[model samples]
Target: MALNSFPPGYTRIPTVSPGPEDYPDDTDALSRSSSPSSSSRRPAWTRSFHLAAAASLFTVCSLAIFSALSATRISLYSQSGHALPLPTHQYFGLETAAVPPCKLWGPGLSEARQNVEAVFYIDFESANDPPLHPDLEDVAVWLEGPARFAADVSYAQKGRYVVRYTALDAGDYRLRVDAFRRTQTGKPYAYWLPLGLDTYNVTVMRQDGSRLRGDGRQELALPKERCRGDEVGSRGRWVRCEDTPLPCTRYGWIWVPRDCIFHIYTPDELAKQDLWIALVGTSVWRGIFFAGVDHLFGPLAANLSAPTSKFWKCWGRLSAESAKMRISYLDFRQQCIADTGALHCSGGDYLANTEKMLGKMAQERGGRGPDLVLWESNDNSHSNYTMLSLYRQWFGPSWTGAFVSAFRTYSPEVPYTHQEAGNIAAYASRNPEAKVETLDISRLGGGLFDTMEFPLKQSATFHWHNKCDYEGMHSCSPVDDMIFQIAVNRAVERQRRLPPRAPTPPATEDVAEDIRFCLQCPPSLDFSMRPEEDVQCFAGLPL
Candidate 1:
């Protein structure tokens, strides 16, 4: 959009199209020229000769044309807005509510595993960009705990407009801006923060002290202990005491800050979110879910594939946008199907190929075939009935066999699941001499930002994935968390209700499975890559 006017007031800002030459008075030109009357007065033969001589009269017509041009400039632009007869404001400049959009840099975290990390970036270069609250300037710094949503803050230097958050134990945390200044006018400065997880403003925290903030406004000097855990830089000397030093040019000081505080998590908050997910989730999906395992294993980032080759072609990409999905569909195939190099195939074939497709991920990975093999050595068939019965009960009274056709296939290799492994798990329970207690999968621990490839919304109880979304050919949108949570919570409950386990039909697919969804789903951050640039969960959308 172009400007309607400059800073000062002046409606005289008319279309100054007509030039001074177009408005020439021409009075002096007339005086110097011979008059037409004088030319007509010449004698007949002489006048004929005189009329021929009157060819100079062309100058007379030129004067009339110039006068008309000046009239137009004065008429058209003298007034505007509602005064025009035709549509006047169809493309008005100063009236638009929309602004140029800024791209949302994805969540910021790096695998180099440094002392600090950048979670995401927000571009703020638009007329409609969310205004920077004046309060932000007044906020000095602060600390936050689990109950608090604020990330711990630190200063890169005195004039920098940037900051970061840090902690010791890993989980989730959010950054908040709480600047409230008092003025004699009784006005307020900026004061807003997000309330819950739906905004995806939902944060993940850890204990590195090295955290989610960084700035080039580095200090020229470094404190003695600043480089303790960090390596010395390229320069012979590790410290540079000068201010405004070049970026990556030398090392600077680091510490925790104090306006950047936590929102404080409480048992009450969990109660507010409704802890019912724990009670019924297990009966939905058993060993296939990773959320339950996530709690046990720790944050997902800790267990991330280690090398660049292990990562989604981590070396480099064509762009900020391209890099986001650089891991092409072909690669998804090679890794899950063709590249049987080391059984990295999880979701098995059910994740990618249709159940009707030629191959079954379950057969390849799930006890060498899709169908469950019953062993007489296993429980006397009562075990199989127990599982199938529970599966049928959980599907409720309305499902067709569709659920088992799709969801039942081994995901990520049938999960080494007792239910899918069938009656044997129950028989194993019946046998007195089995060696181990039960399941012995890994634990969830390690670095911050540990997350599954595809995190599920809280409402998901259990559902089946077509080969396209899961393992068959490595299509993504992974939902290991929901299934994990369901199983674990059920296991925890079993501690209270021991075996002679109830029956559950493992195979079934239905939309009704999702019993609840967050009523306050934060409006999607379609703006994360657009103008609203930030989301509004607590403090009405910033600006």
Candidate 2:
């Protein structure tokens, strides 16, 4: 229910490993054999028949096994919109936001003669998407078997919520809960990404410079609290305790492999799931080694410069492998919306590309209403530029709302400046009242971001057009400054001040149609894969 994710474009690699439906039925096959000698003594033809028969039997057994496994799974669905189970004997509690035991909830189980419990611990940090349970009301739980529920809003537990369930019978059963939003609106959802890639350096050294294509080896990545910029890029934080970094690295960057694409040779069915990849503004632009669009304070330097072949090489691979061709650009747009909904755009100066894509769909479908739009990047550059002048008056804030980088943190030619990044942070920090939540659309695909004052339950928005810096043991060409600036605007609007008294209009038939159109918009093609055709300007659609 909570928007606890980040920007999209994850690599969904096709695995040869067994899926949830696959199971080993070799138990029966092995049991039927009295001894290896007897099995080997069977006639060749008979043995072949036995093998084929076992294979067929295994297939059927697998299905039965799957059914049994699924039946035992803690599926938490509710029909009455709500319900509860009585406890046989046990206490209830909440858990932390870690991965193992893996923040799960299950129906009551048993150990020996004693009754066991289901732990409902929500990990806000480890979650890559929105919070499993959004608002408490949006949440509904039911315990199978005879059930009774115990909840106390009366006793103050401080920041966390509490619930308890008990069972009355010995029969086996599960406890389930459906999470949703009950309030009109709530706090934003944020996620922490150890290895965020936006921009980077082409000449960066590998974390250990040991292997050609590894990010080192480690069990868990350390959190930001324990580290900073000095921390290696390949790993979150380098530990002085161990001679090695928190985790080691083979590549100079986080997720970008030596091939430069995470999701390689993916299948179509898993394409949607591969969009979880993201680019974080934790570092500035690295156009010097990336797209060659460094931000210079002067007029001449302002324009994009020639980029190295490596920049295009990396970009080309990323485009083809990413779920949507323009992964970084589109995901950034969606991120802002997912964090806080429409509230993120009160001042309305921020420009997000995914939002523009949705807006274009709404227009194409002939739905009309008050529309605020952000521009798209990579492909359809002019289409985005043209939308600006289409309306005589702008509904959102003007250029004044944009962030202005204050100083240069990077010094190398084409290097990203912290001053540029400062601009984004400054703008967003100034607009704290923007009520930026839900407008973070990217939550539908990847991450979440909240305000700086709060836990960030989501992500930090807004940044100057700085490239991704080479941080950590491993390094990478960071994201483009242009895109970084766009994210900054998106983030700053998180705190934009709104004009009082504008209630949201009712949902109309057009809106319903618009929603459908927005969802159906096919993924954009990669900029590197376009046909070499010239454009003869035909009558194009207008905003």
Candidate 3:
């Protein structure tokens, strides 16, 4: 079977229209000659009996005609036993010639969902367009569903027809259509064909946008040679004519220029890059900062920024650098792992969401992992910050061994703030072989800035309060974001220069000094949060 075509079970039912000679002639209904003259000569009793007998015979014939007409209307049913009403064919007289032959095709998607649309065009053998047949019949298309739902369509363009009806509930749907040509006596003669016969399941998801939930629904999946993007609607490079000297149209392909394309790196290409980072957090990362965050970089730029209702600041420098250096920076800030041990993440679980975001890349690029992943967690936050371990595990053994803590942000709340920072930093410290980095913005006075706005605004300079100076949770300022970006870029670049698969330990002391002056910890410290919790306080004492 073709990847996207309907299965072989799809078949067309043939309907036949009877000719004028098919019905028996009504010889008994013929008028009698000289009826008035004969009645006058006959006896009154004889005339009365003749009238009574004629009346009885006429009533019987009328009843038989009604039964025959009623039998023509047929009811179609879905495979699931949902019944749909077929249109009543009104025939006027006998047909002289046969009904023009045409095939019922489709269940094609329409922008409107309250309807069933199909085509009744005649199939031709040649590549050339065929002329419409003069004797072709008018066709009707209708949709039927569960609960006796029925609708007929009168609107048609040439051989195309659209049957509009009330929005149907979720269930099986069947398409019933007929093409009727007029006999010389004005009688209708045609065929009524059922196209899909419930073999095609019709699942209607039309509230936001219309989508079907059946296996036969159409989705474009272009192979590597056909399109640059792994899936449909993804921005990608198009194969040009010069690339392979192949006709773009012949193999069901179209060539688009590279400049007109959006550069989307496959997962393998991203893994091969000097830097590929994934940001994990909450509303701060998902809705507020992450949406359209990629637009700030690359060739596409709109000065548009996020809503002013939150602590989001533009990442112009970071995005620009990413574009220039071709870095892959991903954000996974959606809510995950509620405080009560529930995994309410998008698409069900952590791994599911991960696959949703990167599975296509895995399929296209042959299973590769990102180079660096920067995750965020706040102890005071509602989420269970320890769930990061599950996320770490989801990445699996190839990427989870390093634990380098280079920066810290501090808050006045002693162990609550310190403990929160320790929970995240210490977790990283335990993984000696994984190439991961942790910087507690809260420990480095990241929470000290004014909660309403960034202290540095759009400044590229790395600046932040050396210690906790603000009262509430130190919301990260614009400077903190920049510092994180700088650290990530630096680490990725350093990793790129490292010997293949060698333990990528910290090589420079620059980051140690960067976080040291911001907050003071004991000269020597165990990577543990609370003495009672039995958790490591730091990755390795940056002091």
Candidate 4:
């Protein structure tokens, strides 16, 4: 596939159409001359005739000038209706300078190996044209393939530029190069200025120079150390968790933030906890729940219902004699309506529904709330078109900002009122005993800005292309698993710090009695999942 062939819903930068000013101005030439003959030598009637002719000529010239100006104004007004394009090179005072095509020289594309850094050199050398000097900082280099890689660029001796990037997975990848230059006013280009998008197709192979082969049965393990909340939002790249000499598919990679150690608790450690965990959020949280279950227990039964449902609540329980754990997911969007048997929300109040569910959970536990509540709401808040005004302000004239603005204009979801962050803070303050942690999964998937980082904050380019669903709302695999690990680790650490709670009696009813059970399910909760197979689990007898 062409690297420039962006997915549906993305608007490519358009070339600016030539305006009226771009065309040559039409001039109406007028010749003026004075006769040397004196009026005394001519007849009085002749002078009168000459004077009348002069006045007529002046009037004709004035009418012609008015017509020309009116035509130019109409032409410019018509062109203004078309879409505006990026500024031309002449606007940047580089009209005479030639932009030479950037050339790449380094190891062959097939020689790239996984986990090994691939080095390449770029130079703007041409036989016919003189060399061009562009600020290395203005150039942007990134890769699109099975993994996320940021090609590092630095100036070498002379006019050569060295580019370095490491491949994490053995697969085909594309190295995309683009450059941006500021105008005389020092403002960056408002759109993607393509300096050289000479896409290089690279086939990354394992160290053994063999194709990666594996059934999906590889057992994934958690890292020993857990990533902190700050690290979760920090700048980082995706890297294979286990980088053995020989490439293996046993473990998937994780996004490790800068200056942080990211590892999850082992299954043994997770099995030792006896706690009730409640996950309240959008569909993304549903994926995290399944990923956590897969890591803690074995794969779910294949015949279970789909990951999503019309019902508001579902439960996953590990009823072991020694260690008991019950995880309940409350769908903030869905509400069970009595007697209708249809999936619908009443008053469209997500926060109110979430609070109602929490109260119900507490009532079921004999007035004791869940030990830990991992909460998030409206992961699709940025996708709402009504918020385009706010997005334009939040993300200014960068390339990502332009793309986001166009996306909101062209493709937008039904407007959803996002829950206020302060409301979450208030809830956490009210429930001092319970560990109420808010997870910003959107930031992990690059839906929000990273204020601490510059380019990320301004460009919003830290998106995990390979790890996100098509709409870029929910995160797939290792990312979802990472989210689960972080939530569990925080809960475990909080339990160790606080006093042990009095054990509550087992519920008189089974929470999963009406719901189906499944061992096999994709570990992401994006909208593109199995939509046709959704099954509803009605609300059974009240708690």
Candidate with best TM-score: 4
Query: Which tens-of-lDDT digit does each residue in 1-543 have in candidate 3?
Result: 001111122111111222221111111212312112111222221111111211110011122232232121212111111011111222211231343334434433222342232222233232222222323333333333321222333334444334444332333454443333322322221121111111123444444555645421132122223222212112211222212222111111122221222122222222234443434332233221222222122112212122231112211101111211222222333335555556455334434645444433222112334444455454333424444555555555544222223222332111134345555556556653344445543322311222111111111011221111111111212223333333343344335333333223222444321111111111222211111111111112212
Pairs with steric clashes in candidate 4: 223-263, 223-264, 225-263, 300-518, 300-519, 301-518, 301-519
Decoy 4 TM-score against native: 0.39
Comparing 2 and 3 on TM-score, the stronger one = 3
TM-score against native, each model: 0.17, 0.21, 0.28, 0.39
Summarize candidate 4's per-residue lDDT along 319-385 as a digit string, tens digits.
1112455455544332222233332334434334334444445544334445556643332332222
- Give lDDT tens digits, candidate 1, residues 1-543: 011111111111111111211111121222232212221322121011111221110011122332343311211111111100000111222211232232334443221122234443334354422333333222212222222212222222322224243332233333333221222111111111111111133333333433343222232122222111111111111111122111110011111112111111111121222111211111112223212212222222122222221211211100000100100000011112212232233334322332222122122212122111111111212223222232223322322111121122122112222243333334335643321112211111001111111111111111221111111111111233222222222222222221232322221232112111101111331101121112111110111
Task: Specify the poorest-scoring 10-residue window by lDDT in model 2.
Answer: 443-452
Off by over 4 Å in 4: 1-226, 244-251, 304-322, 334-353, 362-368, 379-476, 496-543
Candidate 3's error at 404, in angstroms? Answer: 8.1
- Please tell me which model should have the higher lDDT, number 2 or number 3: 3
Q: What's the residue-level lDDT of 278 in candidate 1?
A: 17
When sorted by TM-score, best at the front, the candidate numbers are 4, 3, 2, 1
lDDT score of residue 303 within candidate 2: 16
Window of ten residues with lowest summed lDDT in model 1: 317-326
Give Cα distance to truth, residue 475, candidate 3, Å.
16
